[model samples]
Target: MLDATLKTQLKAYLEKVVQPIEIVASLNDSAKSQELQALLQDIVQLSDKITLREQGDAKRAPSFTIQRAGTDIGVTFAGIPMGHEFTSLVLALLQVGGHTIKLDDAVIEQIRNLDGDYEFETFVSLSCHNCPEVVQALNAMSVINPRIKVTTIDGGVFPKEVEDRQIMAVPMMFLNGEHFGQGRTSVEEILSRLDSNAGVRAAAELSKKDVFDVLVIGGGPAGAASSIYAARKGIRTGVLAERFGGQVLDTLAIENFISVKETEGPKFAAALEEHVKAYDVDIMNLQRAVKLIPGKIAEVHTASGAVLKAKTVILSTGARWREINVPGEKEYRNHGVAYCPHCDGPLFKGKRVAVVGGGNSGVEAAIDLAGVVQHVTLIEYGTELRADAVLQRKLRSLPNVQIIMSAQTTEINGDGQKVTSLSYTDRSSGAAHKIDLEGVFVQIGLVPNTEWLKGTIALSRFGEIEIDARGQTSVPGVFAAGDCTTVPFKQIVIAVGAGATAALSAFDHLIRSGDEEPQTTETKQAVAV
Candidate 1:
């Protein structure tokens, strides 16, 4: 149930609807449609301009179409609008009701000139924080062009469809019947993917090789810092990143970074990119590296079959949150199990939630959720919490937060649809316990993103790239930094410093090896790294 403040806000938003918006519900099962109908009725009651129309004899159990001005607008939601997806539904209604779509002039023209009929089907888990952005963007595009049919599916509700498509992650996009991509994607990127066959053919025909003086494998703080340092030396530097922000994008608030009192992760990432672009570094975003070939000139191959060559390579590919393997963990993801607390915490507002792990991340997530959720049960497998003293103290101060020690999570018990409870074993007493909750947030630890460097580079036992004091790897010209390397502590400031040191080391190597043009008698200025 929504609070009074949220209800007031929703009412205010609905009152701004310009054109009459109609909700066409295809009802096959009355039991399944009750919640959806109630939600629609509540929304319609807020504004006289909105109404709902039920259509019988539809095959779909719970599907709805939003129409305005007698046009379908090609927007549909296959499941009940709840969780993080509620924002998507609300934004779609506003966009069709006359909200100005914020897009580039070229992008708007491209949407207006769309060539063929494209059905944009977005499969998302309700708990995914990044899912709503993609869904809302496509929905707005649908309003811009009638040919772009947009359909949103709840991955948790329609597990059969997700399985048929072999979708392992949320925010998975599909054009027509072909799988487009997974994760958060921009509107421009989706438009480029409309003609998938032609795009692939064009990419294959233009097999070009790009050579750089120093190539950074990631685009996070470490990679951005390295590229900036290398570019300052007047050398050709480039960075290839999957999303250009790394793990920082998922973070909600960051106060540890020096000089800045407080900032959000996405904002900090954008600032990092702007600073890096201030130099002459070439940034390649949305490129996933699949393989690394070590040699005199190291070669990096992307998922798109593109090859990049560099005299020296810097590996800063960051880490990701590790998954706690247990029964029903993957099956009920986004239904009642979530990974990002800051992103999905609001969805479980006024509801009980469980947090796994006892480290800094786990304790921090518990503290963060304690303010939003009604109660938080933190389960730790270790004897005591491994969080910092300050974090532990803060967590103890929370009245609604409870921490369980030496508890090994055995299984995630769910009702085949959403998580109802979680089962764990007390290692000391050899007893099992289960807690009833609406959501579970896993915050065990981080896993390095160095799997592609298995045979090409020397790695530590934990799959981290082995680096020395100067950030140089075992290979002659190869270097590493950030969480992907054997860094003692994974922090933003430390990664940035590591990146700078690696770039300076690389420049020193190039100078000593006489790779750059020899200094002339007329110019005596030394090259700065």
Candidate 2:
């Protein structure tokens, strides 16, 4: 199962093993089990310190555990850890073999101090871009605290468990057989959920932070760029974000990023975070900005009841997938409604589904889902598909795809627990119709994340932050960039350039305005002009 180049890389990585480790495989007489055995055998050949053992009887066949020779520090993978999870498997091997985990020292200590037994089971699809983070996080915790056991299950491999649990989403997590969460989650978020006092402690710590010279309110490509540029100017730079990488984490294939011919979203996001961390920027993740009060020293209030002050604030909160606001849509979000086709398509294998849109994303989703699903019904509000001609042609060529034009999605019909059909209105005929299906994939455009700044600063009619050519907002020292701003394009490359401009504009404002006193209403209006 291992290729020539992969074996060489695996050998090199395994050489870092400071302690003996064992790969205990739980297998049966099945094709998947045979494949797992071959993979484990290939791994065993790479290092003398590594050993593999097979056990016929186990809860999940074709599964394996990577554990220290004599210790319980380990993590389990119930399927072939390839694709996006390949890095996760390698990290588990090294960390179990006594290699250091690349996490904060305080976080490791907190994991070790956790009191109870926490068994985490995460269901993921190999195509999912968001699964690795959650798997790696839980695996790291298991390594630190033996009481915390993590089992990553491939939804494609074990369809029975997925159906039994009613899982229609990738990276669906369960704690002790109960639903914990679904979608992208971080180690800090998991910790905050488990520990009651974690939020209070974090809030208190943030409240005591010194005023920043340049504080970035988002952590996407734009925020990363702004932080790097500001920090390079020898200013006190800080970043506050609900999560790093922003919408990029939800993205799958990204081939448009210049210099890099092709790369996955998660990988590119990691590089962005790594590049920012190389500087002296203080990154505060998992902090949501609730209110922004502009002044000479701007005050940004977070949902955790913490107030962070800064000389200049750069908003790069970015945008999110627009939801189809129809009845039963919110009720069955993860049950049958999904936004990402790459992540959740496998879960709806062989089931009929509907794609609600005719844009590029919608047509692309229909094409992708047609391969995995039994049938795909594409509904568009416009008379014609707005997708590229090539994409539209490919979608039309699909045998199991159906397209409906001049239709508006009326409602998503579900059976209380899961979606069963979708309702739409024929715009030209003035008639309504419902199609039977198991899932509804909404691929409408995106809405900017600037709701908090509505009353605080100038915003476009569409809610995007209003900014001048220099990336300067109407609030003088305050600036905005990326998808949150009035920037024409929402591409990552454009966001990076805008971030640089905003950072430089902020520096210029700082030097010109001076650090004397807070701006009065009269002076603020004058600066806006």
Candidate 3:
């Protein structure tokens, strides 16, 4: 299961273990069980503090638990934790064996003080890049509080449970057999959901923060660059984001990021965060800016009732996946309608699926799904595909791929629990058609996450923040960058450059408009709405 190089790395990581641990495997006479046994044996050979035991009768066969020798301070993996989850397995091993987690001390205390028993089950795909974060978070919480138990199940290994639960998305989490959340979630997010007073406490803390010289919204490539550049200027810089990494976290592969031959999205996002953390930037994650009021000291209001003031504000809220907005689409989201093909494609293996859009993302999704799914129907509203010629050619070469041009997706049909088919119309002939499928992957495009900024700042007809070459918006002392702004070519490299320009422009504005009076109570109330 693990190669020589991996074994060497595992051995090295195991050296950090300060306490004895046990790997208890529950297996049957199957090839997968045998493979898991071999893997566990190899792990035990590397560390004298580790031991493995097998039990034949268990609820989930071929599953295993990594626990501290006499305690339940560990996590469970129901499938082979390979691919993107390999790191998660290593972190779990070390954490269970008395290696301290790198989370904030306050966060560790919060987990330890939680009162109730929480059993978390997270369903994930091996190829899913977003699953590791959620798994690792819950695993860490479990280690902090034995009352919290985490079980990570591979959707590919246990198809029955996935279908029974009507799961069509990766990293779908359940609490005590009830749906908790879907997609990327952090430990703080989970805690906030569980604790009623968490939001109020966070809001109070944020309200007491001192005014920042430069406050950046969003945590994508653009916001990261802006924060780093501003912090380098020796000013008080802070970044507030609903979540760091933005759309980059959803991206699967990148080959055109300049100087780097190839890298994954999560990896690139991690590097960006690490680079920014090396500076003096104060990062506030899991916070969304609901309103922005411009003045001498601009006020950014959050959904948690926290109003943050800053000398200059940088808007880099970035963009989100564009929804089809058709009938039954919202009703069936995560029930069979998905936006990420890389994460959810394997769930529909040996089943039919549809990809909506004609652009590079849709064509690429079709091409990728052809290798895993039984069939793929590519639906496009345009007359022709807008992908690169090479990608179009590759998509055309696939035997299981079907291309439908000039077709508008009208509705996503579901059986109340999962998608059963999709409805569309022929744009040229005005003929309605429906294709039976198990999943629908929407890859139309992206819409700027500027809905909250509407009426507060000047936005284009398409809802993008209007900005000049200097990245300055219509509002003074306010700047915008990245996909949320009026920048051409929404690429990571372009966003990074735009972010730097915006930061410098902001500093220049601050120098020119020195000693301006703060907003009065009446002035603040006028725009507070």
Scored by lDDT, the top model is 2
What's the lDDT for all of these models?
A: 0.83, 0.92, 0.91
Ranking by lDDT: 2, 3, 1
List ranges where model 3 is wrong by over 4 Å: 515-529
Candidate 1 backbone clash number: 0
Q: Identify the runs in model 2 with alpha carbons over 4 angstroms from their true place.
A: 516-529
User: For residues 111-147, could you state the per-residue lDDT of candidate 3 as single tens digits?
Assistant: 8999999999999999998899899999999999999
* Per-residue lDDT of candidate 1, residues 1-529 (tens digit): 4567877999888767788888888776565577777777777778787788898654355788888857767478888878778988888777777667777686687787888888888887776667776898799889899888888988656767765665545677888888777666767567767645534543453246467889999999999999998887888899989778789877767999999999878668879988998888888776788898877788888887778888999999999989899998998786778788866665566889999999988999999999988999999999999999999999999999999999999989877777889999999999988999978999999999999989888999999999999999999889999999999999999999999999989878888777766445443344443
- What local lDDT does model 3 show for residue 132? 91
Candidate 2 root-mean-square deviation in Å: 4.5
Kindly give the stretch of ten consecutive residues in candidate 1 with the minimal lDDT sum: 520-529
Reference-based lDDT, residue 519, model 2: 51
Q: Give the TM-score of candidate 3.
A: 0.96
Q: What residue runs in model 1 are displaced by over 4 Å at the alpha carbon?
A: 1-146, 149-183, 188-194, 198-206, 518-529
Candidate 1: C-alpha lDDT: 0.83
